[model samples]
Target: MPGPLLRPLPILFLTRPEAASARFAEQCGDSGLRFDTVISPLFRIEATGPLPDASAAGGLIFTSANGVAVWLAQGGRRDLPVYTVGDATARAAEAAGMRAHSAGGAADDLIDWLIAHTPDLPLMHLHGRHTRGDVAERLTKAGLTCGSAVIYDQPAQPLSAEARAALLGTTPVIVPVFSPRTGELLAQERAQAPLLVAAMSEAVVNALGPLHKRDLKVAARPESEAMREVVSDLLKRALAGDY
Candidate 1:
């Protein structure tokens, strides 16, 4: 007699923009996790105004990869030290020839690092329009003399038809949300399919606003590695017939 057959894990619905989604897919592959996936971005990053003058600034702050992309495209100076909120953004900055340092993750962590380092010189934060924490303001209040420039705009987008159909299916869908903004957008979609949310942080889980109560898990840390671990663990539990 053969052992009991195992059930396939739920499909993953990736809501990050094209580039980021591709990176996540690559990570899943590298981790040896296989699952059907749908790429549906809820926001589009668009370059905005001219790059701000950073010639006199002490260093640069980047909270998102989009901001780093915009700054690089605008031909900003790459010699200055680049402070980032996560490893991905730091990698982007380094690829553009900048000396980059990651604060692990989260704006508060970045602010704390800046305070401890005491760069003292004026720091310019290159960011998108839909940013959550005011890194510049927080740093300034701490006597760091930080300023910000909106170099990109994250225009809202909607779920694709394929995404909607997948979300309505009986099979559970694992949605990994990286930001509070993304979580809010997912909540508004009101997907009725069985869902297991992998939120990057507690703030992201809270941003879901009571969507599905029983199927949400927050990452151990506000980092991509932690998010991936949460996703992998949830997939294992789901395959084992454990909710």
Candidate 2:
């Protein structure tokens, strides 16, 4: 006789924006994986000001979709050189009329790209106030003149009482952290459960700090799609079990 399907695994999702949760749900699907999300948005996305003038920026950098969306909403020139840290941001930049040049899918990689296939123009990094890595500083330290604007702040949102209880209860939980802030939150809360933590790169995994490694299995890929792709495979396993 076949074994009883395990109850849907209880997974925790970290999200601040409503949109983020919706996508997470779609990603999880109706697999035997029950989702318990904490609306702990390590930051918020908001328009800081008018879209910058490309004539003044010379070139631009974007690492987050919020940066791309806000700039697109404000309408910048479609002809400027746009550099991005990840593929999604590049796609968003393209949607915003920016002819984007990718930086190898990571902040650090982008810096390397700058050093290699370099652009001969003054650069402006359009980003969130809470930048994850040392890209801008690395560029400037390398003697590159890069301007910047804190277009938004990715502030953390605290978990609610219900979410806390659900998380504290039993079940394997997977957290796919796209940013260090999300990983830091998981590290700080160290709930007693098997954690499958995924990030976008080795740096992002390191950025999670000691709290993450204390009691979790961690995996970091190189892109948002890659992170989601890993989680998708887990859901497929769940479906096969008929849980």
Candidate 3:
């Protein structure tokens, strides 16, 4: 007699804006991680305010691809060297005709990289309204000239009906939270269904508060690849009846 086969758990990527969620979904598909994905963004990325002039900056800092997109849209200069928090942002900057260097991942890592490499450059950080870590402040305190400008805003949005249904459904839901703000938002929703969270860092997990203690898995590094690996492990566990 053959027992029933276990179904793959559904992955619910509650990331910001449509673009980021779509990118994650694409990555999941490309990784051959067999699972249904529901991309319901919980925030909208809107360009707010004008972009600052970067002609005088020795280098530029970007924490998110959203910042790169907004800066490019607002006619930012591409001649200056660009330093990014992760690979994605670095790619975005390069795509926009700028020389970009990736700091591996996380704002703290970016700060460290800047300190070590561009210690004397006048850097300007272009970021969203909601940002983690004080990149500019920390750099300035470290005797490096650093400034920041808000190029975009990620306004909070409610989850879609499909997302809500998926979250509360019988199938296990796997979520990868990239930022503390997004983690906090997911915590507020507090879906009672079975959930496995893949947080980018300890900060993100902390933002989720105490309710998701048991099911939360923090990535080894605060990078998309690390988070994806965590999600892949969770999916494997789910298919093996260990989730």
TM-score of 2: 0.79
Task: Evaluate all candidate structures by whole-model CA lDDT and list the values in order.
Answer: 0.85, 0.65, 0.81
Tell me the lDDT of model 3 at 160. Answer: 84
RMSD of 3: 2.0
lDDT of 2 by residue, 153-172 (tens): 66666666655554565555
Pitting candidate 1 against candidate 2, the one with the higher lDDT is 1
TM-score of candidate 3 on Cα atoms, chains taken together: 0.92
Residue by residue across 1-243, what tens digits does model 3's lDDT show? Answer: 999876756665555678677777788678776787787887888899877877668998898888889988888888888899899889988887899999887888888877877556698988889998999999999889999999899899988888888776767778888888898888888576578889888888788895442377889988888888888888776656566
Error of 3 at 148 (Å): 1.3
Please give, for residues 1-243, the per-residue lDDT of candidate 1 as tens digits.
Answer: 999877666787899999899888778767676678889999988888778878889899999888888888888888899999999889999987889999997888998989998895789998888888889999889888888899998888989999989787766788899988898888887567778889998789888996763388888888888988998887776666676
Q: Point out where model 3 deviates above 4 Å.
A: 1-9, 211-214
Give all candidate RMSDs, comma-separated: 2.1, 3.9, 2.0
* Better by lDDT, candidate 3 or 1: 1
Q: Write the number of the candidate with greater TM-score, choosing between 1 and 2.
A: 1
Clashing residue pairs in candidate 1 are none
